[model samples]
Target: MFGMRKWNTPVLRPTAPFIIGGIAVFYLVAKAQDAMINSEEYKNDPRNPAIASGKKAH
Candidate 1:
């Protein structure tokens, strides 16, 4: 059969892995960004306020 499966068979679609992986990557990125934002280095960086105020940092 060309890409045909019996009604009783269970199939794992290809998008399942990609969907899970995308969620994992999103979670990790959010955690990293939170850490970076909370770090002293970020707080002391003048560019942070400047960016927030919509001013170009020199």
Candidate 2:
């Protein structure tokens, strides 16, 4: 009589969490940048005299 044995394997790599965390961080940064760019405060800042004088260059 011949018998076969099966082996169970476990995941040894710990890269999934790091990849997911990096993606989440990237999304958050992009979202924050978009919000800042679209905000009125950023568009109407006094530091840039051009914007305050209503002479935005295209």
Candidate 3:
């Protein structure tokens, strides 16, 4: 049925791109954390002078 009606289809094109970009950003962050865990920096925990000298009351 060909009925002449003006219907506005809200633009949904940007939704997918936005979601994809967000996922990419979070993925990169996780990858960075993985790299850190593999690095020596993460493996070695630097001693804190303050905590070593005196224990602060919690």
Ranking by TM-score: 1, 2, 3
Model 3, 32: alpha-carbon shift in Å?
0.3
lDDT for each residue of candidate 2 in 18-58, tens digit (9 for 90 to 100): 88899999999999875665567766666655556776633
Which of the predicted structures, 1 or 3, would earn the higher TM-score when compared with the native?
1
Candidate no. 3 TM-score: 0.52
User: Top lDDT: which candidate number?
Assistant: 1
Ranking of all candidate structures by their lDDT, best first: 1, 2, 3
Question: All candidates' TM-scores?
Answer: 0.55, 0.52, 0.52
Per-residue accuracy of model 3 over 1-58 as CA lDDT, tens digit each? 4676588655667588988899999999999875665465544444533335564422
Cα lDDT listed for each candidate = 0.70, 0.68, 0.63
When 2 and 3 are scored with lDDT, the better candidate is: 2
